[model samples]
Target: MKRAVIYYSLTGNTMKTAELVAERCGADLIRIDMVKPMPEGFKKQIMYGGMLATFGKKPEITGIPDNITAYDDIILGTPVWASTFAPALRTLFTKKDIGDKVSAVFTLSGSGDNTKCLKKLSKFCPNIKNSVSLSDENNGKPQDNKGLLEDFIKKISY
Candidate 1:
């Protein structure tokens, strides 16, 4: 099955996890780039806007890949901002045509709150088959989570 791992990262943490997931799954990887990057102090900026966006459910993604029909399965990765999925994922969900594709999600955070992001994703992609969350405290190393990611990939029967 054709698969793709797409992610949005303000810091390197989420990008690192996304790369590992793609490599383990032998799937294509796409980094969602904003036309205008967040301000220099992105962490602070995100912390402020992220809360409002999460509460309001407003995603501000400016772009997405034009052709998403090629992938049968998609894995979305993001960093937890204010205990929720990053706004970029929200934007992707609002703008993309992800109908019928098998989907899963992974989140990276200093603490554990996988359920929040997964729950939000469930609302966007109701048919999502699986999801997982990794804590940054576990050494925050991509290699450490390889086995778990590989297992998740194998479970994606699509």
Candidate 2:
């Protein structure tokens, strides 16, 4: 199947995971970004970003891939904030009609409670075929997660 690995990465964690997914699935890779860059400091960025996410605020975004429906499958990736997906994805969900597409989610998280985020994402994209939560202990430089990533790819690729 033709798949698109779409993601947002504030500090390269999601980007690294997206790269691995795209390479493993031989899928087209796309990155959507927040219109306003989040703060660079780790604590401040998390605090602010988590607040925005918690409040269901939709920040503006750019680099949205054209004709996302053209693909057979979509693999969405985001970093976890306050046990939820980033607010930037709120913008994507608002701007796009992805209801009918085959989708899966992969989240890079520190606390390992990405199930909440995954459930939230599934609510937004009802057709989500599978979900994977990965621990990013190295600040987005994930290690020893190839098995988990591959399993997620297999679940949705067919």
Candidate 3:
């Protein structure tokens, strides 16, 4: 079956995870990019990006596929922010109808606590078949979650 790893990343952690998943699953990579990119640095990102995520702001996104039928399995990927998903996902949901898709999911959280964000994420992509939460380690490097990543890939592997 064909697969697609659709994701949004701010600090590149989620992107890194997406890459690994795509490579392992042999899936296509579709990025969620904001029309006006978020600012760099923690303070600015927290103040501006956090606020948008907190408020569930659906900003304009680019580079995502409008249709979801190309892939039989989809892996949803994102970075946890303010106990919720980044605003780009909100925009992605608006642009693509994925409510009926039973997706495999993953999240990259700084504190390694993504329960809140995953709870909120289910509202967009409700039919999750499997999920993995990875904590920030090695300076937001995904390599630290090697074991968990391998397990997740196994469950979602076809």
Q: Which candidate has the top score in lDDT? A: 3
Over all chains combined, what TM-score does candidate 2 have? 0.88
Q: How many backbone clashes does candidate 3 have?
A: 0
Q: Which runs in model 1 stand beyond 4 Å of their true positions?
A: 57-63, 99-102, 137-147
Report the C-alpha lDDT of model 1 over 97-158, residue by residue, as the tens digit: 77346477888876655777676667777777777777675655544455665677677534
Span of 10 residues, lowest total lDDT, candidate 3: 135-144
lDDT (C-alpha, whole model) for all candidates: 0.71, 0.81, 0.84
Among all windows of 10 consecutive residues in model 2, the one with the lowest summed lDDT is 137-146
- Number of residue pairs clashing in candidate 1, backbone atoms closer than 3 angstroms, sequence gap of 3 or more or interchain: 0
Best by TM-score: 3
Cα lDDT tens digits for candidate 3, 1-158:
77789899877889999998999889999898889978878899899998999989999888877556666778888888899987988887787776456488899887877889888988877888799889887655545588988999999887
Task: Name model 2 segments beyond 4 Å from true.
Answer: 139-144
Estimate, for each residue in 1-158, the C-alpha lDDT of model 2 and write its tens digit: 66788888888889998998888778899898888888879889978898898999999899887777678778888999888888887788788876446377888888655878877777788888688888776645535576877778787654
lDDT of 3 at 86: 79
Q: In model 3, where do residues sit more than 4 Å from their true spots? A: 139-144
